[model samples]
Target: MLKPQMSPTRELISLDGLWAFDIERDSRPQAWTGTLDSGLEAAVPASYNDLFVDSAIRDHVGWAWYQRKVCVPRRWTSDRIFLRVDAATHEGRVYVNDSFVGQHIGGYTPFEMDITDLVAPGEEFRLTIGVNNELTNITIPPGSITVAQDGRRQQKYLHDFYNYAGLSRSVWLYSAPQQRVEDITVVTDIEGTTGVVTYDVQASAPSTVRVRALDASGTQVAEAEGAAGTLRIEAANLWKPGAAYLYNLVAEIVDNGEVIDSYTQTFGVRTVEVRGAEFLINGEPFYFTGFGKHEDSPVRGKGHDDAYLVHDFQLLEWVGANSFRTSHYPYAEEVMDFADRHGIVVIDETAAVGLNLAVQGGLAGGATTPTFSPETFNDDTQAAHAQAIRELIARDKNHPSVVMWCIANEPSSNEEGAREYFAPLVELTRTLDPTRPVTYAVVMFATFKNDRIADLFDVMCLNRYYGWYVATGDLATAETYLKGELQGWVDKFGKPIMMAEYGADTLPGLHSVWDMPWTEEYQADYLDMNHRVFDSIPSFVGEQVWNFADFQTSNGIHRVDGNRKGVFTRDRKPKSAAHALRTRWRGLENQKPGTSN
Candidate 1:
């Protein structure tokens, strides 16, 4: 799960431009060996669904093909060559010169295959990657596919976000030595003014290992000569919210005093814990003030773009926020690296967004049924969920910016068998990485009275749409109900509560003096009401609104274009609710410690 980087011993080439693409139809053979027959091209590092104007292509189910030709570098003959796909939607299979190589199931994580023996240096080979967008009951983010009367396959899921699919991230061809650093795990702590970083390295083979801890100025602060050891820094600069400082931990493989491979991992010296009703970072009470975000844009559709990435963080800074959640899925690795450099807190989440049958029924217009039955989200689904947690932690455990792990979002905690389904998963997450808190976004239906798995989590991340979905424009009743429910959680669980998602959908230009729904004025008023309740509860630790910006969703009458609960519009334009948040958060920023909001 180590991110590919270029060093003196390693080289990287980005396969991130136009590639030949086609869709499978009527049991067509895969374009594995020769050039694709469609003669159509699609951009890499982007979803193919939004790139075309054809409705059939936009809504196509099943698999799509992307093929390109790559020349192996001449110098890479002596090194091990790898073909790395950052992500391939739900499932991806790779073929090199018509020979099947490797495949991976997870859509949001990385997968790689060693191709040194398959091709020679200074030679060209056809690289074909097939991505399947279909999700079934066994997938991590479960969905059901049915054949319509017209004989076309249709995909339906419980999640509200659009199921954008394809090669939504970068693909790379890289080289490394036969004996090199495989993985690096760093756990950081602070004892008084000194920062302690304990690291463990996994190598391809047995070799003498050298580790060095260097500061921002490239001065070596500490060094060790083992595969696993600790580095201590005197007067260490701690990485805090809104103030980031990083140390580079370099690992080198030495064979007879000659360096064969080198890799550097950037990490921050920080610690996170949930003690009683307070969420602490670096042993200080910390508040989360941000939004639940998605890797979505106009045409890219979850593609990782540098321009959008920088701009989104800039917007988060402009809004006077300190934290955000990767709402319903694990985002690109580049996003986590940026957060680490910028000192923004993250609640890392898995792609377990659609596990609730009741929520799916309400949104997708289906009959409510037991969600955890054998035919639905059963043992296979739990196995996939366990793998999702494993990959997520393995990829993100070293990040200081990620303080908590959100295992699922708005699952059916009120349904039968909820406890049986979620208990082992929560235990697995804690076993993977014991440093971070564990939580799941609770739907309004899963309340203190009926929620079976609330006690399994360390924090209560409640996603309640009281005014928008329940009360429907009645703020007075919404406020009362919200306060009562929050009080119930505090009384029952005695844990820190966070309003992980709460907002009203509002059109940009819509206006109403009476504060009607879908108006900018009502969105602002709804936020104020939620904040009043948050300030009154000592156990309420944070507030991240429903969304950072409007995003695309499956077509339905409940959505106009997409979900409009974002404080900012789809294009990063701030709505009136954004101004309200700034006014409150900025004041909190200037408020003295121990003072009330």
Candidate 2:
């Protein structure tokens, strides 16, 4: 929660490079099997499913073991050390030298375990991590590990992305002071030309905390005292959409005139508000025009790749966009940091996707995407869902890039007792940080009349698919129908709304005579229609395409090679729709007062 930076008193070591990995159907013991190199070798912070040539390993729905050897440095004897696993697929179990350390359930967030006594200075230890990518009904992204009559195991999920499982993020060892900073929460606002930053610092022990705000040149602009306080910056260089200027802040914990722990965090001076169906950033409505993207690529799967992160933003910038939603799951911390420095609005969503059981269970009667539902919102599932929300907010609350917190994406909101399920979740998010707005991405099947959870949101985010899913190949009828749906949302609530997901499945080089579906021509025309309808609606505040690019997903009959709804291809090549987006967004980018109230 400390925004993941180098600790002044902490010694950091990268446990990346190569790791011993093996795939197994059953749980393996902690004992070392002879030569780990002779077995299948894979890189750390990557997906094993895409590493091998055999389809069996790619589709294996059971446990995979990752082992490594680590020795603590003797120079840091008095510091408290911990093993930090950034992510471990769906479920993870950690062990240090045949002794069980701890376990974490969710896969997308960072989890750390204290191994101070278990590991000694200059002593080597076997660090075994058992990761299971098996998805059950209770998992946040619901899917099943089903075996056929021939004993062939397969991974089945409702989401439209491949189940790439492994250590998708970095793993490292870090040392901290005996008493150090545990977490920091920051909330900022601007009054006229002055910037106000209010923060709360939590430490392991009681100590005097000193806070300093520095400009881009690293010169101190303001200072404050105490564990919780505010710091003001005069004539603050405001963080805007295109030109994002950031200021650095350092929080130090001192004990008896000794600096025990220090942390440096960066933030932007900005404000977000919703006033009478207008989404305002920095006291005015900021038009959002971007896409809902996934952490996906060619060979790396969902693994965090620096090259893909940099290229994807370039595509977004080329399209003249300003915002995006971490649709279906929370992205890595590095993505948030990039958005902070580059000035992009983010709707940080939780991994509570695939909760709509009706669509997957044939109860919805339409061919909709699958939802992650445990069927009923009972104790264990609810607690896991709630904990994900808490950790997401805790880790991302200090980021100036995050404008809103999307609690879920396409959950079973219209089901019975759905209000009881999400009300507490919304209230919990508000309790954690009351500064940002809270909302979720509603699926296309959700209706305004029977919508059980839309009232709990500050902004109405609807994933409408009028031209593609409902009307199919007809853009004429889809245009009229789409306008009706947009008007229905505004008439029902009159709240600020965003078109979270919209686009058609388009295949590159697939030509059509008259703009048929699946052709690149149809994609551009489909988005053109949606844009035409959105520009006429006054209450519509934003339009986020369904996907920035095509990505991998489970093999199915309907999916040709995965969902082809991207403006760009899987390799980041632009389809025809990419030009349509650029042509429209470029004009909007130069306009002031994004939304006319």
Candidate 3:
């Protein structure tokens, strides 16, 4: 399947801004008629969860409908028109003018529907979408909805993050040529000073897919014509961390020497491998130094905010970080494209969190049952989990910034059905794209001895809160346990290892002795101890901190206001740990803002 590409010829109409919204506790209509009865309006690219003043409406876990009107351009009559939903959370059922269009079940990826015949050109049409945030065992990021003692419905799940829902992305009407280039798959390799770019483009019809590689100045450097071929770039500048240089690959659909449709995507000439105990980028050992981040904010919740996005990038630059993981889900495509321009390494992840089967173990303010809870062993949950992996790869496969594909974040690898659950998923990810390495973040509770699938990945990704979760404010004990645990992984797997997550919850301005917990000094000491242990291990390749910034989580005693594990506060202000990280990471010249080795 090919991903739709953008072009100068393809026209787009923004269906953003205000939209009529309403919530229903009972079942919503399968097909709505005439004018919608939605009573309230909301900003399209924002979360409805945080939009209302009433907490009942804010936390409602049932069906919510979004209705908006869009006019198809009169000029697009001759073109192939389609509707692109950037994202709709959890499960979504869409309709246009009282007619069912399509339904999509994932929250973090883009899905499109052809509405060429549904709407006449130049006429306005009603667009309605019903979104359900209720997570069952069959959903990827699974959870349950229960009525609380206060007569309010709330979600109970595995992940530590909040369940913010609604039309969390953007909606658009776009026009493309009938025989446009559908998808482009690019694979790059640097040999000596030369670069080899192999690409396969899928088109709508039998047309010559003219592929061109353009330099940074938009000048053509290399080109080829056919469905699949290679173009050699002479004296090619390598794309590296910090020095991320990009070349544009443009595909044009030409018939009888007349240009019909075209699409362009960015690619970096680089390669990554997890070879012999070292993680290599461009064939040199590379160490990842950054944080594992979530797309979260104050009022916006997990909604996309461009201002916050740009600010986060600038902060990463200031603090000397060269990479980050999209922790529990694939973020907006805009964020991935930005990484391409900036040379930041990204470990793109799927929203496969909370698949644990254990019925016990709840943190300070959370309930006990796992995400994809009791029924996690069933076939439906596994299918949904696999589908999420497929969607994530298909959407993000073309990005050069995506050096790896993370199958899941902290799944149950130690439970009774662990192997049967993740084996097929791991196989699916590898079969989809073998160019990138694949791994899942291993939770500490799923120790090396108990994890049946520990050696299944190309690299071992460990998320440990040794001092915070175990030893509790004792750095010496934390250091010893961390070393022993890491050594056990090495002795068993012998693969390149990374600390996918490691942090302590610390409140800003909260000061105490370094031995105390939840204080600035304690967080810094805990991280320092972990770093020391990592340096001593030869197979240790990367250390992406637990979080980039403090973020809001569902309320609990474990958190003060929210999770305080960020190096920077929720407002992007640097904490004591952020400064400490900058000082240590700066000394390693290869890890400077623009390069990694």
lDDT of each: 0.90, 0.83, 0.83
The most accurate candidate by lDDT is 1
What does the lDDT read for residue 497 in candidate 3?
90
Clash pairs (backbone) in predicted model 1: none
lDDT of candidate 2 at residue 359, scale 0 to 100: 67
Q: What is the C-alpha lDDT profile of model 1 across 516-565, one tens digit per residue?
A: 99999999999999999998998778999888999999999989999998
RMSD of candidate 1 to the truth, in angstroms, is 1.9
Cα RMSDs, all models = 1.9, 2.6, 2.5
How many clashes does the backbone of model 2 have?
4
Native-to-model Cα distance after best TM-score fit, residue 173 in candidate 3, in Å: 1.1
Range of the 10 consecutive residues with the lowest summed lDDT in candidate 2: 365-374
What does candidate 3's lDDT look like per residue over 500-552, in tens digits?
A: 99999988999985488888998899899998998888788889998999887
For candidate 2, write residues 247-362 as lDDT tens digits: 98888999788899998888888888888899888997877889899888877888888888899899888888788999778888889889988888889999888776666644
